[model samples]
Target: MPAEAGISGGSCPDFIFPPAETPASDGMTHPRNPLAAPVPLFYTCPMLTTLAIRDVVLIEALDLEFGPGLGTLTGETGAGKSILLDSLGLALGTRADSGLVRTGAAQAMVSAGFDLPADHPAFALLAENGFDADPGEALVIRRVVKADGGSRAFVNDQPASAATLRELGGMLVEIHGQHDDRGLINPRGHRALLDAFGRLDVAGVAAAHAAWRTAEDALEAARTDIENAARDREWLDHAVEELNRFGPEPGEEATLAAERADMQKGAKLADDLVAVGAHLDGSDGGLAALRQAARRLDRIAPEHPLLADALAALDRAVIEASEAEDKLAAAAEAMRFDPARLETVETRLFELRALARKHRVDPDALADLRDELAARLDRIEAGDAGLARLEAAARDARAAYLTLAEALSEARRAAAVRLDAAVATELAPLKLDAARFRTVVETLPESGWSPAGRDRVEFEIATNPGAPFAPLMKIASGGELSRFILALKVALAEQGSATTMIFDEIDRGVGGAVASAIGERLKRLASGAQLLVVTHSPQVAARGASHWLIAKSHDGLVTRTGVRPLGADERQEEIARMLSGAEITAEARAQAMRLLEAA
Candidate 1:
């Protein structure tokens, strides 16, 4: 065995074993040759490559490297073993409180590095957020907690936010703390986990839901328009008919008013033009009178020089009067016989003016109003048909969505049956043989429906026979909850992301065979992914493929915490110490030896 006696404690080695080559298997089964005796297989999975923590709580400075398989952290109470987990949680972006910083320390820093498989989702998440990460290198996560309760986070040496750290950390490591708020305890995640377990078509359901929502929106809009149109149907119908009868055109009012003005002015100018024509061209008018005077002056001019000048002036007056007579005749003709036409124009103009006044708009706007009213009336008529069509579409969309959701729900229920059975097997081994694990699948009301589906999935348990099941969070005692969490984790280990799993003393209240059972399950879980367990049970600690010891040391001035990997000898000593406390007896050492050999 690699963990032999007499090897001193130091940093964990950078070596890991590969997974056994075999057919697919679940937590309860391991594949092997049919005729061969059961042989345990050691395998490596994604691991926390290293952790460098400084000035965090009780720890002053620490650097640790972790190998694959179950790496157990063992120490006496108050040895600051938990500070390692606390620092790791801090680096994973947990909320930093002021007390996490050591006394007189300016700030505490924790940095963790992970070695992951090429296809780990953390790589995808990092790429999606434009962060630099290489699968070939260790992915680094760092956090700084100041004495004043302020904090900062970084990823791969690039500045990042706490949220980013939390999100990415969740994909890389799952820390199942004693608190309910951490890990898979939250009910909100239950449905998704169930879906993942069942391999249900989540994207299909989401698409169907989106389609249904779109249909609902369209239906609501159509209904609103129809309702509004119904309220104005009567007025709109009347308006449409009236405007159609009026047959108003763009700029018609201005055109008709102009025509009316021309007709009235022509009528007023007719008499004046006729009177001027009579004065210029009638027998007693200016032209004839000028002609008579010119003839008399011409006859006297031959006899007198003064009469010659007068004859020339009379001839010019006769020509001027003739030109004036022709212009007056033209003007009189243009103004004549338009009184009946003027009456027609005035009637039409008045009608248009009245229409404009009734509609409370300019005459120029009449055509636009007519078209608008016509369109509205059309919609009012079409709304009934449109509303019916949209309603049908909405119904179809809802039915389609429900079909998929119902199918997914059925699949989840089936998966829950298997999950419950699988976890039931784990419970008995963990010393909860009488406890019942149940996955409740209940349909949500319409008001509670969401894109995920209409079913509410919750994990519940009954700790005793014939007891009604309640939510896991309400289990009351922390020990039972932790055990229940452990069972659930073991059952679903094959379904989640490629993350390093951490169980913080989940085997706190159990021992002997129960602790050994937990250890066996933890080893099984490690076959799929790396596992870090903080445990006080020698049975559990002995099962570890690798082990670490956390201890406190003081130089008389200040106290500090430290962690070091236990070699073969150190592991046995630690396990013996765990079995018998500070004073180790020969029986305890022998038992620890037997436990290591069994592991």
Candidate 2:
């Protein structure tokens, strides 16, 4: 068989162990099985296709290509296996240190290339960060660390920040180890994982929560308004009443001022008119004298032409004087003024101005102030009915939210039970038969509620019988912790998992069947996605569809670390070398063949 035959486009038959009976809600016995029934592999192309490292620690220059399925990396201690991971981490935007550069190199550079699906979340993230990313195009992230302790990051050759690279890295890869703090190890992500596993829909609950908050905000605002209005209730009533009795109109102040000025001027003009009237009224005035002169001149005008002209001039003077006296009589009639009416207008103007001063507003704005005060008084009187309606709305919203949250909580508890049972079946084959796994689903108080609902989920474990269960990190040994993480991953079947997963020394302490079990589970996980495992176990190495041997070599005065892909024969020889220390024996070779055949 070819060395990489099972690397892609293949499946392994499901291994059926003795069933561990779990009670179901239907009162029937169900088999708790960790190894799911065989399904076709979903991914044939690797997401991460290439990694290139330059002048990073002992790696002078290295470029590696990868394929889908399990790829094992094995080397002796201090043979630079960790260096490869560190180089990958640099490209993934981990914190950079100047010391990561080679001894005499000016800088270190690392690039990672990926063939992500068009619908991957990283594309959305890139767009949100102002980077133009097209679907169906290759993605490459590069990082350069300078010897002077400065670093720069790039995505597909475009300038990018390290923070962006970090976020993208989170979506692309998950690294699980004894000390890993992200992915399945973090409690903050536990609830989300559980929901994904159970395929629970949380949109309804989230929508209800938002509605409740909005209603509560409206109700609280109404209550505050009613309280403030009540505090000024008596003042509002008095102000409204005073302004209603003295109804002011817009432009009323300007009109009154104009009228008062006209009346004052009229009073002075009336006195002048009286003196002028005396001169135009009597029969001995200018009018009568001009008429008498014209009549005497008319009789003598017939005697000569000059006499006739003089007579015409006297007749015109008489007519002009009579018109003047008529106009005087009309003025005297129209300029008549009453002291009582003037007093009334002045009194009204004074009251309006005083009211404007009391309200600290312009005279014309007093009308608006009156309406506002009346509205306030109206609200204070009608507050109870309005408050009652708002209170009912808030109550209904709260009840709706509680209903959705309670249903979600119940679903989570049921999923937790199933997850615990699935995890239990994985424990025994990995040689933790005495240990027990538990998924805690606890309900938090209302204040702790979130859009996700009010349940807090955590995965806990106990290593021995009758022992108290604690968090996996706190209770399990380093080797046991790695195994526990593997068990959890196997049960989850990659639900909520990243596209590529890496395991560092997951098979550290165990040997024989336990090592074989770990290899089987890793191989099963790789059938659907891609995995890179850094391991020392020969069984784990034998299970890989592709093998890489990491080694340290020296030239003249410089030492470098290198990785070499193994062919069929070379893979057997390497596995034998891993089986027998320092030298490969015939028996070890035969045993390696058997392991490969079994895989």
List CA RMSD, all candidates: 16.6, 14.1
Model 2 segments more than 4 A misplaced: 1-46, 227-382
Give the clashing residue pairs of candidate 2, or none. none
- Give per-residue lDDT, candidate 1, residue 413: 76
Writing each residue's lDDT as its tens digit, candidate 1 over 378-489 gives 7678966877899899999999999988987877776676667657767888889989888999999988878888899999999989988988877866767778887887
How do the predictions measure up, each by TM-score? 0.66, 0.70
Residue lDDT tens for model 2, 92-135? 88999999999999999999999877767788889999888786
Question: Whole-model Cα lDDT per candidate?
Answer: 0.77, 0.81
Which regions of candidate 1 deviate over 4 angstroms? Answer: 1-46, 117-137, 223-382, 585-587
Q: Pick the candidate with the highest TM-score.
A: 2
RMSD in Å for model 2: 14.1
Candidate 1 local lDDT, residue 104: 95
